[model samples]
Target: MFKPIKSLAFATLGLAIAAPVMAEEVNLYSYRQPELLKPLTDAFEAETGIDVNVAYLSKGMVERLTAEGKRSPADLVLTVDISRLSAVVEAGLTQPVQSDVLTANVPAAYHDPDGQWWGLTTRARVVYASKDRVKPGEVTTYEDLADPKWKGRICTRSGTHAYNVALTAAVIHHLGEDGAKQWLEGVKANLARKPQGNDRAQVKAIWAGECDIAIGNTYYMGKMLEDPEQKAWADSVNIVFPVFEGGGAHVNISGVALTKSAPNKENALKLMEFLTSPKAQQIYAEANHEYPIAPGSEPGELVKSWGSFTADDVNLMELAKLRPAALRIIEEVDFDG
Candidate 1:
C-alpha cells in the first residue's frame, strides 16, 4: 500500500515540475511579417525551449502597446527602422535594457542612447538603375540625382516612406535643412513617374521603362533576385552604391527592445542577449540579407555580393529627432503631390 502511495506522490511531483517548464514562455509584439520572422523565432524556441507567442502587425503596434500600458502582456517589441523604434521610446512604451551582448554587438550609433532599443540588423539605402539606360560611373553620388542631367529619369517610393524619410533625415544631418529641402525638391522634379509602390515596385517600374533610376534598400534587390516572379525586375536593373558626397550611404535598422511593463523581464533580457550573440547575429544576416550588428560577422551572400561601401554612421536617434522636421519638409515640398 505504501509503495502505491509513493508512486502516486512521484507522479504528482513530476507534474508540478513540468508545470513551470510549460509556463516558460515569452510574448512578442512584432511589426515584421510572420513569414519573414519564422526562422529566427523557430531557432530561439529550439535553443531555449521557451515558447514564443507573437502578435505580428504591419502597423499600429506602437498605439496598441501604448494602449496596453502597464497591463500589457507584451515582453518584447521588434520592428524595422529607427523612427518607429524612437516613436515607441518617445511614447514611453519601452524601458532601458542593459544587456552586455547587445551593447557589444550593436554599435552606439545604431542604438538608443538611453538603452531603450538596440539595432539587430541594417539595410543600406542604395540605387537601382536601368541597365540599358544608365552607366555606373555616371551616377556615383546621391547628390547627382538632383542634377538636371538625370531629370525626368528617376523613380522612388513616396517620400513619406520611412526608408526615404530616414534617408532624407540623414541628408538633413549632413546638409542643413535648407540644402536638404532643395535636394529633395530637385529629386522630386526629376521623377519619371509619380512616386508609388514599395522598393520592389520602384524596380518593377524601372523594368517597365517608366524610369531609369530608383532608390531602395539593398535587401529588396536580393528578394527580387530570389523570387521567380520578381526576376524580371532584378534583371532589368543594375544596383549602384551612391555614397552621398559628404554623408556616405544612408542606412536603417531592424531593432528590438524590452517593453516598459514586461512581466517576464528576466526572460526578455535573455532573449535580447541571445539575439545579439554571434550565432543569432548570423541568423539575422543570413535569413534577412541584412548586415549583422556584430562586427566581423559575415553579412550573408546577397549582402556580401553588393561589395563593401561606407555607411554614414550618423546617430540613428538623430534621424528620429529630425523626423518631424523631415516630414514637414516632405509635406511642404508637396513630395507626394
Candidate 2:
C-alpha cells in the first residue's frame, strides 16, 4: 500500500535495460563472387528485412575469419567445395547449426554429419567430349577416360584444384586407394595438354581440337552457352553422363553455415532457412545452373537441356576427409608434372 506505481515502473525499466538487444544485421563472408550471389542476398534482405553486409573474396576467407576470431563480424560463411568448408570447421570457425528446414532440405550425405555446414547446390563432375571425335556411348564411365585408347586425348584442370581433388576422392571411395592411384596414373597418361585453367578451359581445349575429351562440371557448359566467345566452345562438345555402372556421377557442392560467433544468430538462421526454401532453391538452380539440394525443385531450362543423371551416392563428406590422401596421390602421379 505504501509503494507508489512509479516504483514498479522504475524496476521494470532496469529489467528492460539489462536485456540484450537483438541484432538487425548479418555479415557474410563468401568465397563466391558478389555479383553471382547478389540475387539470393537481395531476396533474403527483402524477405527478412535483415540487412546483409557481405565481404567477397576469392581467396583466404578462412584465414581472414580465423584472424577475426570471436571478434569477427561475420554471422555466416558461404563457400564452394567440401574441402574449403571442412577447413572452416577444422579451424573451429563454424558452430553447429540446428535447423529442421536445413536438415530436411539437404540430405545427410551432402552436409556435415555434425551439422556444421549444409550443401546448398550440387554440380556434377560429368564428361564433355568433342562430338565429332568421340562417338556417343563409346566413352561412358569415369573409368573409361583411363582407357589406353583415349591416350593423349583428355584435358582437365590442375589436380590441385578443388574440383579435381574432389573427383579424385570420389574415385578413391569407389575403387579403394590403390585402384584410384592406378586410375590417376592412367588418366595422367591420357592428358592432351598439361593441366591448367578452370573447368571451362578444358572445354575450350576440346573445341580447339587440343583434346578430344575433358572432365568438367555441368554448369560451366551453361555459362559457356550464355557467353558469345565461349558459345562455340559449348557447341563443339557434347555432354555425357558418366554413371559408374554401380556408382553414380561424381558431384560437389556450394554450401552455407552459421559462424561460431554469430552476432545475429536469429537472422543468420532465417537466411539459411530462406535460402533452402523451395523458391530460393529454384533461384540457386536457375542463376547458377546447379542442382538444388532441396528435392523436387526443377532446374532451369539450361540445366534441363543438359538432361539428368544419377549422382554418386558416396557421401561427399568422405571426399573432404580423404582430400589429403587424394592430394598426395595427385602429386605422386605428377598430375601437373
Candidate 3:
C-alpha cells in the first residue's frame, strides 16, 4: 500500500523493475543520502524483490515522524549516532524488534537491550597524529590528550558537535562527571586554535602544520585517501587508537531501527535481516568506510590497514544517556570559544 510521495527526497531505488502484481516495498527514513545507501538497498532489492524507498532527512526526523504518526509510510529508520537512535526510542517513535537473526548477527554491546535498535557498523573515535611530528606511542590514551605536553598542539571540531559530544559522553562514562569536566577543560587549554571545523578539517590543519595531532574518526582516513584534494592530508597522518585509562578504545555506530508506524512490517523485517547478513554488511561497511559489526564480515583492505584495537565494552545506550551531561560540560567550558 503506497502512500502519497510528498517530495523528491522520498524516491524509490532503481534496483529492480517493479513487480507487475502488488509491489512489495519498505520505506526508510535515513540520515544517509540515497546514493550512499544504494549499494545496500540495491542488493536487498535484488535478493528479495522488495523495492526500497528512501526519504533522505538532514535533521528534524523525530518531529517529522511524530507529525505523520500511524499514517507514516516509513517502516525503518537509518541514522548515524547512538543518541539519535535512542532519541527515537525515547520519543515513542520506534518499536522493539524481536528477531533471532538480529540478535545473532549484532553483538549485545552494540544494540539496545530491549531490541529497539541495532548497530550496522562502527567507527572508532581515534587520533590522527602527524607522521613527522608526533612519535609513535607518544599518545596512547584519551586521558593523555589532556596532558600539558600537548598544549597548543591539538585541533578538533566544535565541542558541541554530535561526534565530540558523543566522545565527551564516553569520557563521562569512564571518568565521572567531575573528571570529565576536568578533561574537557584540559583539552580546551591545549587547543592550538578555537574549536572549529569538521573532523576532516582538523586533519587538514595537521597537514598544513597548524597542529600536531587531531581528534577524528577512523573512517575519515579512507574518505580522504579517496579524495584527490584530501589525499595529502590522509598521507600525512597515522591512525592511533587511544584507550580510556582502564578501558579499550572508544567506538560509535551507524544503526537502524523499526519505526512504530511501519506500513510494511514484514518487508522491513526482511530488509533488516538481510542487512545484518555478512554479504550486506560488507557492502554497507565498505561503502561507508566503517567497521562491520556482524560476524564473518571484515572491513575492506584500506580499513584493515589502519590496525585494530579492542572496542570499549560500555554499552552505547549508556553513552547516549550521558549526551546531555556532555553537552552541558562543553558549554560550561566554552570549548569552542
Q: Which candidate wins on TM-score?
A: 3
Query: In model 3, which runs have C-alpha deviations exceeding 4 angstroms?
Result: 1-23
Model 1 root-mean-square deviation: 7.8
Candidate 2 displacement at residue 119 in angstroms: 0.8
Which residue ranges in model 1 land beyond 4 Å of their true spot? 1-23
Candidates' lDDT values, in order?
0.82, 0.83, 0.89
**Candidate No. with top lDDT:** 3
By lDDT, is 1 or 3 better?
3
Task: Assess every candidate by TM-score.
Answer: 0.92, 0.92, 0.94
Predicted candidate 1 versus true structure: per-residue lDDT over 1-337, tens digit per residue: 0112011111222111211222466667788766666677678878887766666766887777766667666789999998999999999888898777788888998898889999888888889989999976988988888999988899998999998888888888877799899999999999988889899999999899889999999888788888999999999988788887776778899999999877678778878887777788898778888888787777987678778888887889988999988998999999888
lDDT of 3 by residue, 35-142 (tens): 888888878878888778777888888988887777677889999988889889999999999999999999999999999999999999999999999999999999
List of clashing residue pairs for candidate 2: none
RMSD values, in order shown: 7.8, 9.2, 4.2
| TM-score sort, best first | 3, 2, 1
Comparing 2 with 3 on TM-score, the higher-scoring candidate is: 3
